[model samples]
Target chain A: MEFNRRQVLKLAGLGLTATATPGLLAACSNGKPAAGDGSVKFEGWDYEATLVQQNLDKFTQASNIKVNYTPITSAQYVQKVVAEFTGGGGPDALYVYDDSLAAWVEGEYLQPIDGLPGVDEVYSSIFPGNAEAMTYQGKRYGLPYYTDSNCLIYNAEILSKAGFSKPPASLEELESQAAKIKSMGLLEHPIGLPAQLSDTWWAWVWGLVFASGGDLFDNQQAPIMNTTDTVTKDVLTWLQNAANKSKVLDPASLQLLPVPVDNAMKANRYAFTIGARYALRDYNDASKSKAAGKMKMALVPSLDGKVHGTISNTRMYGLAKDTEVKDDAFKLLTYLGGLDANKQPNTAKFWFQERGLGFAYKAMAKDADVLASLKKFADPAIYAHLAEIARPRNVLGVAWYTEFETEMHKVVQGVLSNQVQPSAAVASLAQSAETLKKKYS
Target chain B: MSVLTERRPLGDTAKAWALNAPAITVITLLVAYPIGYSFYVSLQRNNLKRPKAKRFIGLDNYKALFSDDAFLSALKVSAVFVVVVLGLTVVLALILALVLNERFRGRGLLLSLALLPWAMPGVVNGLMWRTIFDAKTGALNGLMLQLGLIDSYQAWLTSSTGAFLFTALAQVWNTLPFSVIILLAGLSTIPSELYDAATVDRAGAFRRFTQVTVPWLLHPLLIVLILETMNAFRAFDTIYVLTGGGPGDATTTIALLDVQTVLTFTDFGLGSAYAWVITAITLIISVGYIGLLYRKGNFEV
Candidate 1:
């Protein structure tokens, strides 16, 4: 049958409505209301996801609250989570990086746990540096997932072969020892540190600077590392010389991330490198590392050999500001980052015992089980010593820290690549920080 | 009666519009709204991290971009990247298209294999290149070692020039197949009569290629140039995976910088300004290509 134009138009209109109606209805429908059934949604960067699920299962069994856990890729975790939060849907509780805490708090994506149950105990138990890292503008935002300080990890066999029984105690000694190791044909560029242009790159720089007793910013958030006599300058100069002039630093470090640097250490390609204390676990895991059983952690070398310190970092479990199941979410947060109802640091113990993850709890340092587990992959004494001295970078407290970190990565990269002198690069970074601070303020 | 052939009353016109309403609405919501919203966002100091401080800042974000050293450096990097990738892709694609257009054994298989890189995702392509160019265990170094080309493994991605070249080459590998297909289609459409006439007029092979082939393929080449330019400008996944705009700002394209600003820094206003700048650049380049290749409503040399 031949249809008239008007009839065809009417038929098309009906078909179009028919096609779009379901989608429109779905868009309007709130598929499931959150927080009504004692359930919480948790997210974190992917790292031993099976273990996370097992712990979540334990939490669910103990608390009688169901949890939906999702693991995002670590590299894109912040971007993906921020996008979800911006779009008005995100997990109830999620992992928060210490460096990103200030930005997330400023963005109002996270809620303070200042008045939450067991929060005070959680704060009092963990290391003060980690607690400070989680706090922004006088309010605590989360509890620690794990905390670690950057330590100088060395291949003991390689260093012994190069006629060194102990790790270098100063930056000058590190360079000279690295040069001897290189000259002996044990390894080319015997020092390895990740200088890749990433947010984490600043951590390595800050760790070295802190080890040398340099302050990047004052308490008032003003730049302080611009002067030539500062340890920041000394650290930057050493890094530049190691990468370019002395050539004891592997050029590949400029392209490597933390894991790759660890892998390089495992392969015994370097006599020394700076990595997180926890990475010592993987570095000494015989099954995973060829250099296992020979790797040892040393204090991060400094300029004067008098001050010994490193940059500490923490990853915490934070509550989303808009979480519907606030109580359940807090329970999950406490379970993962603090103590459970039994007052036992079950999650922290599990992570430390299983993965050799550093614990934020000060008590964990003295726990027999934690010490025994630490001895399996790392030296408990060195780990304890580094923990005692490690301090989180002061810049992390500022809202402009992320932007400053990005600029810092560029400046550090510029120094490593020999595009600019360390002095000029440090000055440039200070300028960048001041500009960002002013703009953000 | 056929809908196109039949005359319609004004009431029927209303019916036509009513029928199109759903589509129009969908387009408005999905396409137009974001563009309009982004323009408004670009004009404000809408840093997500500083929500309380956000306010209407007019063209301040755009003005700041002119002085942003990172953004300016990214713009330069993007310019070099687009030029290098486009030149390599168009030239190599034309050569491949010309070769594949000729009758040969396994030509079908060759064409099929040629499309494999294009079929691979950008991230995968990047990973593949990264493995090949990796400093410690890369196959390139291993091959060079075995062949006695170099005594030691080299850090290929460490140098700025090497990183930029390898990244561009990876992009070219991913994009060349599409251009080849386009040029091949254009080649098929080129009437053999033009080639025959050129040959009959005593034009040599090179002369025939210049006189007949080049002129005939201008439209397809124009499409390739415009598309590859935009693709190169907006390339993120491959570069992000490969080098992450690194070593120093060696490979940070405007697109990478834009994402870093928006997501990493959480500065929506500045990021939107970056997005608009990229869009404007892409539009200008596209229009320039069109005008150069097409004139008086027809393809021209």
Candidate 2:
């Protein structure tokens, strides 16, 4: 059977066409739902990925629903996930930072979970502030993954050595104590606060502002922190004084993010700092820190020394709008964030017992196992009280908040560096917020 | 043999095109399409978070950039970074190339050592520099303290000037090796007789270098200038890791700003505009370098 030249050419053409057809067809198919494999795709920032996978496996075993888990670097997670969603392919269920919820919802990347099964029960179980954080435009979109507030963390040994038995209750007291510690040669900079231009920085800033009883925006969402008498200006002034006049704030704080700040605390380089309440567990871990068992948490120091308020931040499990397997995805979400079939907050309990992670569920505060775990690293009473007083940021649900937060980082940096005056920075930030609001509107 | 003869129906140009078709197709898909799409995106308001707001705004994004404080500050910062890094790199690379060109002991080892920085990823280089210059536990502070340079550790990266200079130094270290390799190749091709003739003319060492070495290396120098200029303009990873355009926009290059605009702010149109401006600036600079170094379709020398 000798083939002629024409027949060979015809066969080659047919083979080439066959080889390319599938790829061409796939390229033409846009916005198509993923294959109905009954598997839910889940993504979160890289934090204890091993534990997350183990938990996911547990869910799979118990519920018999497949879950594909992906952990992204915390620094790149938001942008990478947003890009995936914009390109019309993303996880069915994903961890969503409260700050990004409004923007994501506005972009139509996330669907409201108000109608999902057990949604109301989950909301009722969590703290009201946490529930509010998971809602945007009066619609619930997620269940709380974790909730925490920024507190004043102190190195007790350093404070004791510096002749202080208790933590400072006011910003002035904190500055004076830090200066004394610095003067005693106990530490070059006795205070550490994250001022790096990242999400952590903005969170800490909001915590400070809230602790001082200042609001970034009013009920109408108009910028109100620019006023001369506002606590926002006072907080900036205190930071400026600490960084420049008193020289008590670590200069390296300008370059440090949350993780590095925690590391610095563990190394006992900072006598005091503003950090998440959850970090206390890591701070007191003997295997991980030299300053272990010497760290203590106190209410965030405020201007008046009486009103100790701080910003409560929540991370939630949200469902993507384009997800075809909504039921399976919601099951995964509930298993991770809400409750198990036994109506137990198993995931929340696991996170708390293992990592000292704060929970949105109020019942966890009174759970005997959780209380016993809290005793190992933290004071249960102080932790519970901090949560009771913690309020979510009013601007978290604004579509333009992220852009405004970026600008605020730069302005605060300028203030810390003494490049811009505190009042000037406040005014500039307020102006930036106005511009972003108008742009988004 | 028959198949080869059968291609006679196709001309040489068509045959060449057919052979190169795969490469051309890849370039069109990977390179040309992205560039064209970026330019198209630049003319519209394409914010991912504000999808409904997207529309053809016709150069409004570019117009807004000139008035944007962050963009302007980034431009100034980029200019400083490029000028300082390029000037330092060119001089250091030429000196190292000249030194390496001479007969020396352990020349191969030294050459290999010089390229170690180039072998490293940009992020690693930035991290290395950060550790060296860290305010609290930096090796530089320890070394300086041992030498009595200061009584206590100084915060080197806290100031705008310090951050800019150190970041520029890191860029120079990462880029100098490639420039040295190019100049070394150029040095190898220089005729020995030219130097001998300069010596016979009683030209001094400086005069010989200026008259013989520089003229012979003009084309290579031009290549280094254009490449380094473009690299310095668009540098992101190292700067991002090192300073993150921080301590108040001290190190925010246009590339970093573009990333923040597009990824952080999700404003693609403005980011694309920033990217186009960078490309335009880099192209103009490359053209200027060529105009200065080349004449009559050849090196001026």
Candidate 3:
């Protein structure tokens, strides 16, 4: 059909308008929202994405507030988040790790959050140390959500078959048992310890250090890396001894920890591993495990003939200093962190799976399902193990821990590989620690 | 009437200015400002982990980069990667293009199929290759062993040499397709009579190719080579996804170092300094490539 001049002009104008609208809208909305309802745009990696969303939904349903979640990869999110903050256009709330909390808080990028409503409840319910992980400059900047600590996981059947009904009570005894299991040719390593940069590495080291009465740092906060009192030396020596000296564990433990764990429990490669509680959860989730019900949790072996001292790491939530709606954000935070938050079975399960974060909530920790699942897959003594030694250390700055550990990893790996002697490795670690003290300071 | 005509000329100038104004403004705001800010950041001693510790320490970051072991390794990796990837891509693409030029039964299908790898996203390609190279259950190891080509599964990512080899292969796969397509377009432009004349002179296929096809395709090949080289130099996603620059820093590139310095370590000043160094290196290579190409008479006709 032929169109008139007016119709043609009208269609042309419509096309022009459509093409121009987005640009115009972007120009208009550059500094403000179009709807006039002030909205804060938060961006970060989605460690507990859907769970955070579900909690946000709950908060919204309870109160008329909305949150827009922008998820990026962990490393990318930090870069972009810093860019945003530097540009003065960052998200009001973000997901951050402990390593980042100190830096951000020290930078004044985070608001002091201890005074926020329901945060106190979070502080008490989640355990003090978990909250302390998010604290910097003597103020809490994040609310604790879930925490994790390590335990010794052993195959009960394997232990029983080796003529032991219970897991080892000391590091020496643990080694003896490991030797027995190793003699049976059932495993490449009796207690699978991955020397990789995971919670296990820190846990294993920290347990030995704390139990042996070795302080990681001196009173002046100078890094005491090579002291006889420091467990760093003992832990490294023990691992080397186990793998290289005794041949109780495989040499590849220098590369990975979970590999040994997976091989032992799931693939029937070993009888035991000193791993995180999440490993138990992982065991139950894997359908290929032939020794699921046969496994049990125990306190990680103590160095000084006491229960192993554990260090717990928690995933916490903090209100962004730049958040447009701090009150509402706190409500969201509170709702997610509330005692009853995990009461909803689905929400509790969501918390467990999304972050692999253990609960700070005693009730949730002792929940029948949680306990049953832990008991079903974990060695028998793990909960008690966590209770005894899974305390948080507020002394080491989060950022410092990573730097210290990274340097220590080189030393540990060197010792394990026989590239360096224990004393030489420790001496170098001391030097590195001194360097980090300057760098971090 | 003359005044009116003059007014119209002025109006045309005004119209031209208006058309270009927004673009100029956008370039200034988006590109110029960020570059300026990044430069400013590069000169400072800033830490994202400790934002309160932002201090201006000019050239310290630059000085530090010269001493960083990771940065040096990354620089070496990037240099090797770019040169090797560019060389491999150009040669492989030329062969593929030459093969595609001749009329075959499934030429159209083959050409389209060849483009599929290029069409896939970088992440997908990285992940696909990662899966293929998986030590435990990878198809590559399984197939190789089944075919009696190897006795045991190779840990392609764990060993330094193996990781480097696999990473380079992944990069070549990602980049070679673009080279092929560009070279093929150049090949299509070459007169068939030139090839016919070469053949009539009793020229072998290789001689005919080198004498006739290459000179004609030189310009396109240079463009392909330079662009792919730059891309390979900045290859982050594939390396990030596949090896994570790991199995002990075997695959870490300059870009990954810049990212880790900035984000993971929260050392913004150092990161920006590393970034600036990368940009400088890239610019130098780009300029060098252009100068060499021009000198070699690739741009003459």
Using lDDT as the measure, which candidate wins? 2
Put down candidate 2 lDDT per residue, B1-301, tens digits, no spaces: 4555544488899999999997999799789999999999999999998889889999898889878888899999999899999999999999999999999899999999998899988999999998898877899999999999999888787788988999999999999999999999999988899889999999999999888888888899999999999999999888888888887889989999999889888889999999999999999999999898865223332
Q: Per-candidate DockQ versus the true complex?
A: 0.60, 0.65, 0.25
Model 3 lDDT tens row, A1-441: 999999999899899989988987675453433323645455557665666667667667767777677777654665677666666666676666665677666656678876766566656765556766777767887765566777777778888878898888777788888898878775546765565433223565665565455666764556676764556676667776876777776544543545544755676566767766776665655575776667666776766556457667766666777566777667656665554453443444457645445766655566666666555555435564475466655445655555566556545655665656777877887786776667667
Q: Rate the local accuracy (lDDT) of all candidates.
A: 0.87, 0.88, 0.69
What's each prediction's TM-score? 0.93, 0.96, 0.79
lDDT of 1 by residue, A352-440 (tens): 88888888999889998888888888888889989988898777878888878878787787788888798898889889987887778
**Judged by DockQ, which candidate is best?**
2
Sorting all predicted structures by DockQ, with the top scorer first, yields 2, 1, 3
- In candidate 1, what are the lDDT values of residues B53-111, reduced to their tens digit? 89999999999987888889999999999999999999999999999999999999999
Docking class of 3: acceptable
On the 0 to 100 scale, the lDDT of residue B224 in model 2 is 96
Could you give candidate 2's per-residue lDDT for residues A37-84 as a string of tens digits?
Answer: 778988999999999999999989989999988999998998999888
Could you list the CA RMSD of all candidates, in the order they appear? 3.8, 2.5, 5.5
Segments in model 1 whose C-alpha atoms lie over 4 Å from true places: A1-33, A199-201, A340-342, B1-23, B296-301
A best-first ranking of the candidates according to their lDDT comes to: 2, 1, 3
Task: Tell me the deviation in Å of residue B119 in model 2.
Answer: 1.4
Name the docking class for model 2: medium
Q: For residue B143, what is the lDDT in candidate 1?
A: 99
DockQ of 3: 0.25
